[model samples]
Target: MSSIRAVLFDLDDTLWPIVPVIQRAEKLLYAWLKLHAAPVTERVTIESMRERRQQLMASDPVYQRDLRILRRTVLLEAFADAGLDTRLVDEAMEVFSKARNEVTPFADVLPALENLRSRVMLGSVSNGVADLDAIGIAHYFQASVAAHRIGCAKPDAAIFHAACDALGVAPAETLYVGDDPLLDVEGAQKAGLRAAWINRVEIGQDRVLPSHVTPDAVFGNLHQLEQWLKDNDPLTR
Candidate 1:
């Protein structure tokens, strides 16, 4: 492992549990649509919208990386069918974006960031749209690379390389910490960066890790990760 000069993070599950945040955002978005776009509301519930989105994306996979465009396409199609104005699309997105960024990070996040950021450059690489700046943690990061903005997502080395390019570091000198085994650990490894899995998900007795995925290290939380970095201070290959 080369010395880590910069650290990149995955946004959603790695810092804050994302399921509830996204659910709440969707609910709020639907409510807003119902109020402002009654024609659309008459035909679609949140469930129906989700279904339509899946169907649309299934037929056209390019929107998978450009989620904002994907979502806008879904809304435009739905609105056209409902005889509503497609111009409201941006407003609807603003509603969803606001709710999406209303996240509370895990207890360990702020503290660990305060510790490590002064010592190393920090950046965010995420497939999600959550805005760390809106979430009030933007000060901690030097740059943010998102799938929608970068034209690719995790598991692709290009996105990781983009973050390293922004931070002026090589992949070998960067550390990526994330939660998902394949998207985070294996993705970082494939990108030629050291990876640390923040193993926060609780699993049942029968739960098992994917056998093919390997990580440079694993920690239960950012607190433990911080400690590991301290122990391996000036960490090197």
Candidate 2:
């Protein structure tokens, strides 16, 4: 086995439950719109706005890669459609971005990170706009690479390579841990890093793995992962 010298983590579903974060942020953004951009609230419901975002994501490749731009574009279009001043776009984005960064990390996340960091270099690579500083976990990571900043999303090897490079480690000596089988696992594997699937949620068997993509390790939580590394790889222990 390649001795693991560093570990790169996926921020969203791996470190925290992202569904609730996005849902709460959407509600907060809509509430802000209702107050300041009343005309926008009149024209579009929250569900409609979600549909619009999906449509915009489908319409362009950049939208799929950069969530902040996608959301700002949506707000601009909404304000323009309602004849509201576009200056409010920044304010509205602030409301959503702040809420989006208010994520609650999983219970096991900190402990695992503390244990793992002692044994190896730690960093993060995310496709989302999660701010590590805002989330209060910035100190744990030696590097944090986001797709928006790099102009490429996961499932593309560039983002993974960027994270490895930032950590001063070759991909062969690093392990990538994340929740998504295709985007995180397959992407890291293709980028030449060992990959571990962190299945925090209960996934049905049918939804587990793509036929051609198998993770080097799979665990239900980060604590389990730490234990697995200790049991399977003496170097990590």
Candidate 3:
């Protein structure tokens, strides 16, 4: 086994449940639009906006990695459809971004990071647009790399390599922890990094990982991953 010297983490479902966060943010965004950009509400409902975003994402592969731009594009399109000023996209984005960053991480996340940092370099490899600084967990991470910043998302080796580069370590020297089997485990493996899947929601059978994409370990949460490292990994000891 390659001795782990660094740890990289996925942000969304790994640290916090992301669907609720996006739901709340989108709701707040529409409410904000109802107050300031009312015409958008008149022409666009939140559900329809989601469908439109999916359609846009299908048409533009770039948007799949760049959510900030995708959301802005959707806002512009919606405003244009309503014959309203396209300038409100920025303001609407701000509202959504603020809400998006209002995330409450898993209860075990802070403590696990604290424990792991004492033994190894810690970094964030996220595809989502969560601002660590705004989320008040920025101090825990030495390096933070995001897909939007890199113009590529997880399941792509380039973004993972970029993150390893940021931490001055070979991919094999880092253990990547995340929730998704494909994007996190498979991607990290492809990039030559060991992976641990944090299956907090326990979608065990439903998320049957392929034999080729099997993770190095399956953890119930960060705390379990942390404990397993201390108990088994030589570097952590």
Each prediction's number of clashing residue pairs: 1, 0, 0
lDDT of 2 by residue, 1-237 (tens): 678889899988889888889999999999989888899999988798789899999989999899999989888899999999999999999999999999888889998898888998999999999999999999999999999999999989999999989988999999999988999999999999999988866423225677898999988889888988888778899
**Where does model 3 exceed 4 Å of error?**
202-206
lDDT of 3 at 173: 92
| Candidate 1 ranges with C-alpha deviation above 4 Å | 202-207, 235-237
**Model 2: which residue pairs collide?**
none
Instruction: List clashing residue pairs in candidate 1.
Output: 1-237
Tell me the TM-score of each prediction against the true structure. Answer: 0.92, 0.96, 0.95
Best by TM-score: 2
- Model 3: per-residue Cα lDDT over 1-237, one tens digit each: 778899899998888878889999999999999999888899989999889889988998888898998889889988998888888788899999999999888889889888888999999998889999999998888899998898989989998899899989999999999888899998999999999987785423236566777788998888888778888787797
Where is model 3 poorest over a 10-residue stretch in terms of lDDT? 201-210
Taken over the whole model, the C-alpha lDDT of each candidate is 0.84, 0.90, 0.88
- Candidates ranked by TM-score, best first? 2, 3, 1
- Candidate 2, run of 10 with poorest lDDT: 200-209
Which order, best to worst by lDDT? 2, 3, 1
